[model samples]
Target: NVYADSIEWMSRHLNHRENVILSLHPHNDRGTAVAAAELGYMAGADRIEGCLFGNGERTGNVDLVALGVNLFTQGIDPQIDFSDIDQVKRTAEYCNQLPVPERSPWAGDLVFTAFSGSHQDAIKKGFEAMDARAAAEGVSVDELEWAVPYLPIDPKDLGRSYEAVIRVNSQSGKGGVAYLLKTDHAIDLPRRLQIEFSGVVQSTTDAEGGEVTSDQIWAIFTDEYLPSQVADERWGRFELLGTRTSSDMTGDVELHARLRDGDDVEDTTGHGNGPIAAFLEIVRGRGFDISLYDYVEHTLSAGGDAQAAAYVELQIDGERLWGVGIDGDISTASLKAIVSGVNRAIRTRQLESRLAAV
Candidate 1:
């Protein structure tokens, strides 16, 4: 209130020439610099001046990035584009030697991200609605209403996305994420999976407001690929606890596994040419018939401590689905891969159902 009033008074008394410019520069001593600057602008101030990302002495100056994106969310095309927020953050951090907080609005790492099952479900449904609406209206999702749960504005509006940012802008997208997984972690994502997972990488990149590191990418891969205990509920509650495999003289492998989805535990036995085959046989007996479409395996490193990564493509419900597993034992990796494939398919179906309900 005082700052805006003072600006009005100053403009009236201090101007001797018509060329004099009235610019409002507010410091964030009380965390009201942005509000003060806005008020001063309404009070006939020609412009507002502040540091990028609010970097300055004491409590910091007004964040010009925040101002820009704030206007962007309100259907205003701000003069400045903070869409490539990470690039802006990098430049601001470089020039000002100050780090933007991870929780900062429009530019924070977690501000636009949706984590947990419920939040993910809501966002998924929102995206589906957005896509459908965009298609029906024959408009880009960016040009239409942006009401995706948790995410305020499309990163496209800000000029950053997986495909756009990764290759041309040096950021994460589906192809880049898949390449990183294959090269660094030995995870060769299928073509469909690349498309599906790119959405994830896109959101993560947007959430992180920076380059998604290899380690972060690996973490996302494992979390999304692994079979959760909740999966066995819809497809017979049997979470694999432990496994035992033995071969007979006839070249058939007898596999036994301790399966527990809840507090109850049971043992299952199946016979086939290998552990993976026997594992699928066990699942087949449970009414979920799955056939191996393709299988690939590789070692993560050399020598003793190396871990094996297995990629199992299974034909389920006329869809070619993929699963991945990593373990010290190749057989175990194969078995886990089979299980992961089923779990991944179930999760995909669950998302579809959620979208349908929406």
Candidate 2:
């Protein structure tokens, strides 16, 4: 509704042009505040009003930063400058001013980054193309890189430094090497090196089965600088059980795991159907039927020592539960995931039982 339409509207008497910078303040009280704000934008409002990070009254208001970026991506330049969004974000955190979770879209740690090999490959290709475009156009690479895929807008446009573009951790991919190298050493490893190094990293991390650090990568790279095919470093062991190898090499392997859990006696061998499956089977066999519903796995570290973590949703017929597990071994991680799911199931069932008794 136009501000002029209000019963006591007086601003309408003043000159307000059609090309106006309209702002929206959405309250979470009704949850439609953001939607209403977007509606205003759609109705040709030039500017949207919002708090720096959506810090406002109960449930907060619209996140202006997110909205601004979204507008920028849509080719509508947000005239309001927030070139140093990162600094602003940090300040917001340092002041204990807000509770912005890392999972928040556009501003989260994991938003632009990917872990799966396929996703990494795609992002790498996208940046490569963007780089090529800038080279061909003779424009600043900063200008060209803005249109790269996955990224809504050029991070630089919002004053974000390249340092935060990609973070290499256990869950990272070969692209991570390029990301880190570009940021840390101002050197971009050629494609061949990235490919060769990924396998090295995977093997080194998987075998050692521990956290791999930047220093370790540099040491390994210096020690064994091979054009291709370096011998396996044999960092850790993956114990296989149950499934027999079909001559073709494409079959599911049932995984049962013996994991190091704290001190000696607490060490246990959980089971699951798949990796987690066999792990669950082992646990159920031990008289603990951890009812599980959902499980999600993601790589944690970048190159070597990438830890796989599993979050399992569980609910017993009459109880409630929650469980989580992590390990270098994907299968072992799956086992932990199942345990988590089972625990959640127990919790749910228990909740139901209590409700029924009441």
Winner by lDDT? 1
The alpha-carbon lDDT assigned to residue 283 of candidate 2 equals 58
Per-residue lDDT of model 2, residues 18-65, tens digit only: 444444456657655556676666664545566766677887778777
Superposed Cα deviation of residue 35, candidate 1 (Å):
48
Kindly report which residue stretches of model 1 are placed more than 4 angstroms away from their true locations once superposed: 1-174, 182-196, 199-211, 227-238
Writing each residue's lDDT as its tens digit, candidate 1 over 1-358 gives 8989998888888757468888877999998988898789878788889987788888888988887777777888887756577887888778877778887766766665443334544555576688799999999877876787767777666655523212201243455566556656667666566666767667776666756666777777777666544654433234567899899799999999887644687899999998888889888886776899878888888899889888887987666777777788888888878877777776777789999999
**lDDT score, residue 296, model 2?**
61
lDDT of each: 0.73, 0.56
Error of 1 at 254 (Å): 1.1
Clashes of each: 1, 51
TM-score of every model versus the real structure: 0.47, 0.48
